[model samples]
Target: MIRVIVADDQPLVRSGLAMLLDAADDVEIVGEAADGQEAVTGAQQLQPDIVVMDVRMPVMDGVEATRRITADGFSRNPDAPVKVLVLTTYHVDHTVHEALRAGASGFLLKDTAPADLLAATRAVAAGDAWLQPAVARDLLAEFAARPDPRAPDAGLLARLTPREREVLVLVAQGRTNVEIAESLFVGEVTVKTHVGRIFMKLELRDRVHAVITAYEHGIVVPRKA
Candidate 1:
């Protein structure tokens, strides 16, 4: 079973998520927290497989809590290692970006259907991530409008093979790994491998950074097409 914790300041929110998740055969709502500090505490104590964390909470906040849980700590154990799924209502521009930067494995909007939400929780627990499409579009727009002032790591870009380069461009275009697989006429596993290699070669933290790198390096630009 994929054990999970729902963390949100609102009681109804947590209750609703618990309800939706409880119905899934593969998921169990092991715990719930009404604030960020409590979420962190519960995470340390319960050690659920994935944490569905709200971006805003009364104490400590999700970003800080996520940072604490996912940060490289003293011990590494399968039962207790935490993976965070940032759940939020906001998707204006940098909300999703900030969550990923804080080490969240993935993101989902609060309005997401229960099925998709459950799938997102599962995805993050299984070591995969995708910002919701709306979230991705907002982020890409912001990235294109005001390119990060800092320069891309050119050396990292130099390390990618031509094929990997093409793959990354699509990734930067906000295509999911499955989409990239279809586009490239390869299996999803192969696409994942290429993505992993790209991350390794670029020394990138995750797909979020990969997208940023692709744009900041002028490899992709905003297009209405």
Candidate 2:
């Protein structure tokens, strides 16, 4: 079963999410919190597989909660690291970016379809990253526009092989592993291997960071919309 802790300041939001997730047979709502601090405490105590976190909260906020929950040595289950999926009301905001940098595995709009939200939670719990395409594009554009963003680390990028480099570019372009496999005329497993290698070689924490690094390094520039 995929254990989960739902955190939101609003009681209705918390109850609604809990109800929706509880309907899934493979998922269990192990805990619920009204604020970010409670979410962090629940995570440390319950050691759930995933935390459905609200970006804005009364205490501490989701970004700091995510950082604390995902920080090394905080989670007792090191083998199965607790993943965070942040929900936000706004799109392409700084809080979303902060949450990602703080170790959130995915970001979704609160109004996302119930099925998609469930899928995102499951995907993150399964050690994969998820992001709404439009949000991701806008977020990357915002990041790229920042003044004096860190220069691309050519030395770190040099660690990747040519194929891994291709994979990273595709990933930055928001292509899923399956799409990348089909596009490259390779098997999905091959694409997965290439992605894993790309993450390892680049020292990326997850796909969100991989995308950020790709943008920062100019491997894939955000297209002007």
Give me the candidate number with maximum lDDT: 2
Q: Which stretches of candidate 2 lie over 4 Å from their true place?
A: 147-152
Best by TM-score: 2
Q: List the residue pairs that clash in candidate 1.
A: none
* N/CA/C clash count, model 2: 0
Q: What TM-score against the true fold does each predicted structure earn?
A: 0.83, 0.91
Q: Over the full model, what C-alpha lDDT does candidate 1 score relative to the true structure?
A: 0.79
lDDT of each: 0.79, 0.86
Off by over 4 Å in 1: 78-81, 144-152, 174-178, 187-189
- Model 1: per-residue Cα lDDT over 1-225, one tens digit each: 999999999999899999999899999999999998998889888878888999888878888888887777711573446888888786573655666667787788899988899888777776655568765755655666666555356777888999999999998876888899999999999999999999888766566668767866778975553
TM-score of 1: 0.83
> Predicted candidate 2: what Cα RMSD to the true structure?
2.0
TM-score: model 2 vs. ground truth: 0.91
